[model samples]
Target: MYFLVMKMRSSRNILPLLSTMIQRTCKFSALPELTKDRYPNVKRGNYSQIDTKHLNFFKDLLGETRVITDENECLGYNTDWIKANRGYSRCVLKPKSTDEVAAILKFCNENLLAVCPQGGNTGLVGGSVPVFDEIVLSTSLMNRIISLDETSGVLTCEAGCILENLEKYLDEHRLIMPLDLGAKGSCQIGGNVSTNAGGLRLLRYGNLQGTVLGLEAVTANGQILDCMSTLKKDNTGFHLKHLFIGSEGSLGLVTKVSIQCPPKPKAVNLAFLGLESFDKILMVFKRCKHELGEILSSCEAIDADSLAATTDNLNLKSPLEKFPFYMVIETHGSDNGHDEEKLNRFLSSLMEDGTVEDGIATNEPSKMNAVWQLRERITEGLIHDGYVFKYDLSLPLENFYSLVGIMKERVGKDAVRVSGYGHVGDGNVHLNVAVKEFSADVLNKIEPFIYEYTSKLRGSISAEHGIGFRKTKYMHYSKSKEAIDLMKSIKKMMDPKGILNPYKVLPQ
Candidate 1:
């Protein structure tokens, strides 16, 4: 299904067709089921258990080659990124500044020890791994960048950089990084500002709580709190870096950020559309926000079992020719002949009122990265199509894709696939569910019945993926027990020996 596309401008023909364009394993064939043995009532948080004098104080404060007590190099920081949580983390450490992550969180909060705070682990839910053996603390050697005002585009970096290497170092100062993802080549802008990561230009340079603008974190007693403010006007006091953006490292440990970057768009365009239902994908997203106004950026929404789970598990090909729903639409501008004459006068008014039924438009960048690798690699092809679960919702784009058709009829026929894709201009919908294997009666019919139909349509059961460790018991189905008891009294006042990241995002 050509997910949202457009390029028809004819009396006969006027040209608008251009196209072109990971065996990064672990979808678990075995050896995954260990997120504290698949959440057996989550226990184990008494802390302090790294032994050998706390591994000789993290091998004498990050030495012995940045510590990592081998177990096959700490099993890739105790696994994640769609292995469905398997953290064991027996020492990983690496630290490369920010005062060595505040001397390993003030010596793991005076040796109560728990830690976790990894980056580039590319978290999906099990927030940067490490559950029962918490002691990872990596930041991939705090990949610095530290500052690049570019006459006020603002950027600061660290917290192990790498979010497509700061978008190619802010594309040589033309600037960007107002967020965009599909795990930006291995994610990490301090885990995208501790999971405030809303990608694909967050429907035009938005979210990351308004593109960051400050951060420093490090709490659990090792104190570092600098609000790093690169300023977009800080009215000061009580913006305490919004207590670590999305708070998945549980109240602190971010280590440095400072965003607000957006300049790199001197005209770009793309369209890949075909639709039949979902009310023509909300009447072509309200005529692409009033006819590609301000050169829209990303709109994405896909279905057709999420592009047949990326052509039956990642072989990737689908360009156009199947319409049960799809839309990709994108645009960013500064003028390419007025952004291709406002995307060819908004695809000649959707081919004279056809609501973009079929199309393909491009401005070539390898044909717009071959149509954004068909919507950012459909979650690595639904984790190679099987036993996946995913979810990151946010709904209310008219009840967004209606819970992927009520989860394909409440997972009818015991699911081998019940799909959906995301960021339809920020209503966020990465809902997925595959299963050629692994099932506890289809994960008990999709958890809390899809968080009670997304809290009866109030919607937002972990939108940009943050109440980690697999949706921290659906966090009161989207908060409000006085906002989760004021987020557990600010995680017991900045991790009072809860020792950071333990059992993740509170809710225990």
Candidate 2:
């Protein structure tokens, strides 16, 4: 038996791609038409004034091949790693050079169209995602190492350069990027510079504020701030590039970075030590600083829970016979034997004085990575347990444990489980809470209390993660009212339209 199909035309006089009744009988029919009005439309946006002609103008400015409008190809650019924030842009623009970026920005500015600049999209915050369906300007194509000067220890690269590649490039030349992160493989240098990322090495190499000599960014007005210089000392009128660092792309789009690299150390040593109390952490740091001096490259802490989670997750042996508040200390030196001798002396003295509990030392590459994995993979295990409320905080190192104790008391046991770890030397502690669920009401009640306590202690709400959309509202507790107002005024002056990463660093 055969069925006769009847087609119906809608208000637009377009034939129904699939008849509701006919679609059921036949296995296949015509493909569903893309409902541009329903699916592709930007729900909340101020760029309605922008016309297709303007888009075409920019498309023509950049070659037609570089403009991507297909839905499949645009999916990757629309969302970031976490999948929390996302929007479907009309098109994705991939520019290969700074000139292309400038031209596109100029066209967007003239058309009054908002632009969303994207890097590796590995950001935990929603800064890289488009809240509105503005044109996504991707730096992925702009990745190119322009120069690397061994003598000056400076590496200049386009914003889209991958952090891991940069590290590899520097390694081949016996140099290193001053910053290193767990997400180094995926995060871009542009995002790093834009967020002013502080990572594990910050304790030794310092933050980007010191390592980044200069930066070049494209402002909302289509002007590029070309501050890419390797000058160690420049008494300029103002250190303008510093403003864009950690701005989360609110003021401008960073295009190129000229970062100061450090010479690679000849030797490195790793030690995993157990401690009974959090209070002993400060004492341990002091002793290490005094005894190890500049060789103390890293000082990180991990709680008992973190150790168990990491060991279980990675299927590795526990570094110690018993799990206690753990600290991983790393030392680097020009001479391997000298560094080892210093580390041995320090450990021996600590053991004799009962400052350090049980300890394990490793110079073996595999063993070193094993211990580092235990420290790095602690957060990854939280997902298996339950929902997580991750907090990257900076407080007095002494208050770390007591703060967790208070939180556990407030949130209640089993309902909330807290694990502690992070760069202890820098005072940035990763206080993660595991819960069954997190609702707006609970977050509303809990966040205020946490921020108030942190503020009372004269600590920052966010240490490494910048004030992106997630934590913008809590900025008041972290910064003074006057400081926030000045930041707003600066934002207004720099980006009059507030199109550059709107609703990101500033509270809505």
Candidate 3:
């Protein structure tokens, strides 16, 4: 297979053929049926159904084009990114401005109608979609850049602004957003904040809690809470914006965001290296941090099985010889000459000390992107392999790769592929298991075992992905009863009627 892939790489036509084969191999003929019955405990709240009066109110508030009633058109809103969950939302409301959102939510609160605030619909968990007949309030149409203070590097934009578009705008201003993800093209800044999305740049720029200066969100009662302060250091009272940062829209509907953008780096470099084992990978990471210092932006790792899955599914050849583990180290600095020199020295030291088996480093933009594709596209390639059971965890670096081995042994023949990869610099590992399809027996073998191992190691079960509907039941595995009780109290106080996103984040 490797030789075939190498040969195909030599020709352009074969690449397209491989792509078509992959599409066919990964395509799902029909998604698993998802209904309220799947979650036996979550019965529909006693909320009023959408009637002509509600339709007229929405139509009058946001024109006929913005209010969608057609079931076919609402399909996109009803399905999640992984297609693991489905909803039956009958109406999708697109509000253009904060006032429009406020009006809609106010009416919904008065009428006892449940509302699901959606943006981009690119979330892994089923947080953005409705579970039953809740109204889908989409921010897709509210995408507008409101302000950018180039000197201060502060950006204030509508919550619906696409992340990639924000990055492009920042490129013009010689700045960049603190976050970068594979779904940046479709994920909205508002949604990013709502979920506290931490992507590739998280190792360097930190998470949304620090990057987001302020934001304006509408509560369940349609009251717009104005916390949109662009100031970097405002010692104001409660610092309420932090409440909504990772609340998953169960608290409020984020309408606008004020984020602090860091100046874009002048020089960027990436080093893709093949390591003999996880120990070697860890040694390289420690040495890289000591050597690269401030310029180190990202340090990620992928196991051999993950690389093979990616190569087979996407027809992407490994840049180096196959190994048990691979690390993609990146550097960002102000001077190209200094950055290149630092990266080269680090690579030379690793090779000389036998820390790295084989590697390739490049500063070229196109080549850098190609190297990143190997790491960023793993999630995309895994979807084709089979039904993927994904767990994003933050563990002690020593125990990061242990679970993959354990799961492989437990699942035995039932598992097709058990792969591990993620931002190793931040101790976050994405462990994915691919099987032929969803199986109750297979799940029983994996779940409590994996979560128990994670909890015993004193690690977080959810590193970046919020506890959407998927992980709501497992919250106890990571958090304490007291902590969960406090969270429930907050949720109750903020959204007393449970009109906000139901059965998400805090478990019922």
- Per-model CA lDDT versus the true structure: 0.79, 0.76, 0.86
Q: List the residue pairs that clash in candidate 3.
A: none
Candidate 1 lDDT tens digits, 451-489: 888898888888887877777777888787898888788
Greater-TM-score candidate between 2 and 3: 3
For model 2, how many clashes? 0
Give residue 456's lDDT in candidate 2 (0 to 100): 93
TM-score of each: 0.37, 0.86, 0.94
**What lDDT score goes with residue 443 in model 3?**
81
TM-score-best of 1 and 3: 3
TM-score of 1: 0.37
By summed lDDT, which 10 consecutive residues of candidate 2 come out lowest? 1-10
Query: Could you tell me the lDDT of residue 457 within candidate 2?
Result: 89
- Could you arrange the candidates by lDDT from highest to lowest? 3, 1, 2
Error of 3 at 86 (Å): 0.5
lDDT of 1: 0.79
Residue 152 alpha-carbon offset, candidate 2, angstroms = 1.3
The residue pairs found clashing in candidate 2 are: none
Q: Please give the ranking of all candidate structures by TM-score, highest first, separated by commas.
A: 3, 2, 1
Candidate 2 lDDT, 1-508, residue by residue in tens:
1111111121223221121221111111222222122223324546654467866876777778888888888877776543435566768888988888888777776666777788888776667866667788889888899998899999999999999999999999999888988778888999999988998888899999888999899888878789998887887799998998989888889999999999998887888887778777778898988999889889998888766655554454655644458888998789988888788878777767777766777677777777787776666555444455667789987776566777777776644457778898889988777664544454554677888999998998889878765677889988888999999999999888777776578765
